[model samples]
Target: MLHLRVIAPEHLREQVLDVLRNEPGVGNLLFYPGVALLPEGDEITADVARECVNDVIRKLKQLDIQHEGAITLHSLETVLSTRAHHAEEAAEGDAADALVWDELIARTREDSTLTMTFLLFMILACLLAAIGVATDSSVTVVGAMVVGPEFGPLAALAVALVQRRARLARQAVAALLIGLPVAMAITGLVTLGAEAGGWITLDDVKNVHQVDFIYRVGPISLVVALLAGAAGMLSLISSKSGALVGVFISVTTVPAAGFAVVAAVLGDWSVAGRSALQLLVNLVGIVIAGVVVLVLHPRKSLIPRSVQPN
Candidate 1:
C-alpha cells in the first residue's frame, strides 16, 4: 500500500482529491482544501507509482489553484490495504494510467546531461575502479561502482529507446559503447605500468580467477543488468530515491570493468575477456529491460476529446 499526500490550493482541492481517489489501489484519500500548515515528513503523492505521473500533473494543472505543492509516494514495506504486497504491485508495473515511452526519456534528462559532466564522472569512476581491482579490495570495487557515472547514460539509453528518440538514442548508445572501453583501456595501460613497478604483483591479482568464476558468462550478469536498469529508471522518476540503493547494488559494470583492467595489466587476457564479457552482459540486460518496461507501461491520456490540441 502506498500513501500519497498532495499540497495544493484550497479552491482546487476537491478536484485533486477526486482524481487521486479514482487511482487504482489508492485508498484512504484525504485532502485539506482549507488547512494551512505544512505537514511533517514528505508528501506521499509525489511517490505515487504511476506509469504517467505527468498526466496526473497535467490534470492537476487544470484546477489552476496550485500555488506551491508537492506529492510523495512511499512503498510500504507491508501494505495492509489489500492482500497484494508493494513488491507484487511494483513488479506488475500496476498503476492507474498507461505511461508512454517518452516520459522515461524526459525523466532521465532531468538529472543527467550530455556535456563534460558525463566525461569527468566516468573517468574518475574508472580510475577508482581500476585501483580497486588491482588491490583485490572488494571495498574499493564497491566504491568504484558507487562512483561510476554509467547509470546516467544507461538510464538515458533506456528512455531514448522507449520514446523512439532516434537521434538521442544513437547518442546515448554511442556514449555507453564508447565510454567504458576507452576508460578501461586507459586503466589497463596504467595497470601494466603499476605491475611492472612492483607496486602490485601477479600473485595479488592472478588469484582473482576465483572471483571471476561466477560472472564469467551466462545469465546471472544479464539478470543484474535488467534489475539495475529498472532500479536506475525507477530512481530517476521516483521522489524518495530509495531505488538508488538498488541501482548501486545491481550493476556489475564498474567491478567487472575494473577487474578487466586489472587483468589487462597482468597480461591475463582470458580473465580480462571474461570480465569484459560480464560487463557487457550486465549493460545489455539493463538497457533492454529498461526499454521493455517503459514500453509495457504507458501514461494517461495527454489529449482529452474536448480539449484536443495540435
Candidate 2:
C-alpha cells in the first residue's frame, strides 16, 4: 500500500475529496483544513492500495495539485487495518501485477543521470573486472559485475524509448555512451601503467583460461542478456529489488568491457575484438529485450477510466 499526502488548493478541496471518497481502494482518509502555511491549502492524507495508486495519482494530477499545492506518496511496509485489506481486495488488479508508471519514471530519471559518483563506480567496477580477468578469478569478475552501475541507465533508456521522453532518452544514452568508453579507457591506461611497473604482464592477460568466458561471444551470450534484461525490467516494475542482484550477475557487460581493455593493453587485438563484441552483444540484447518487455506491459491499460485524461 501507499500513503498519499496531498495538499490541495482551497477551491479544489471538494474535487480532491470526491476522488478519494468515491474510490474503493482508499482507507483511513484524513483531512486538515487551513493547516498548510507554505502552500496555503488543505492537507489531506489517505492510505491507498498499490493497485489503485496510479489512478489516484492521475486524478490528483488532473486537478493541478502538483502546481497549486503538492502530492507526496510513501510505500507502507505493513498495514494492519481491515479497511486496508478491503481496499486491496476492492482494487482492480493484484498489487504485484500493478505498474505505477509515475513512480518508475521518477526513479529511472534519477538513476540515469551521469554524476561523479556514477563515473567513479563505473571506473572502479571496470578496474576490478580487469584484475579479475588478469588473475583468472571468476569470483572477482562477479564482484565487478555486481558493482557496475550501467544497468540503471540501460533500464532508463528502455523506459524513455517506451514513454517517448526525449530528454530522458538523451540522458540515458549519454550516460551509457559516455560511461562505458570512459571506464574502458581509464582501465586501459591503468593496465598499461601496471604492466610498466611489473605488476602485471602480457602473459597474464593471454593465459586467463578461467575468465575466458568474458571474451567469448556466442549465441548463448545474447540469450542470457535478453533474459537478464527482461528479469531486470520486471524486477524494477515489481519492486523486487533483491531480484536485481541476480540480474546483475547474469549479464557479462562490465567484465567484457574490462577484459577488452586488458587484452588491448597486452597487444592482443583478436581477444580485445572478441571481448568488445561480447560487451556489444550484451548491451544491445538487454536494451532490445527491455524495450520488448515495456511494450508488452503498457501502463495505460492499468489506469482506471475515471482517472484517465480526456
TM-score of 1: 0.62
C-alpha TM-score for every candidate: 0.62, 0.92
Clashing pairs in 2: none
* Tens-digit lDDT string for candidate 2 (48-75): 9888998999999999999999999888
Tens digits of lDDT, candidate 1, 1-310: 3445566755455677777655543444454444556632213242344443445555665665244555544444544543233322432243433342334555566434555667666767787777666666666667777777777777777787666677677777667667777777777777778877887776766665424442467776677678778767655654336778668755778778877778767777877788888888877888787777666644444444245332
lDDT of 2 at 98: 75
**Error at 212, model 2, angstroms:** 0.5
Q: How close is candidate 2 to the true structure, as a TM-score?
A: 0.92
| Alpha-carbon lDDT of model 1 | 0.62
Off by over 4 Å in 1: 1-103, 110-112, 209-215, 298-310
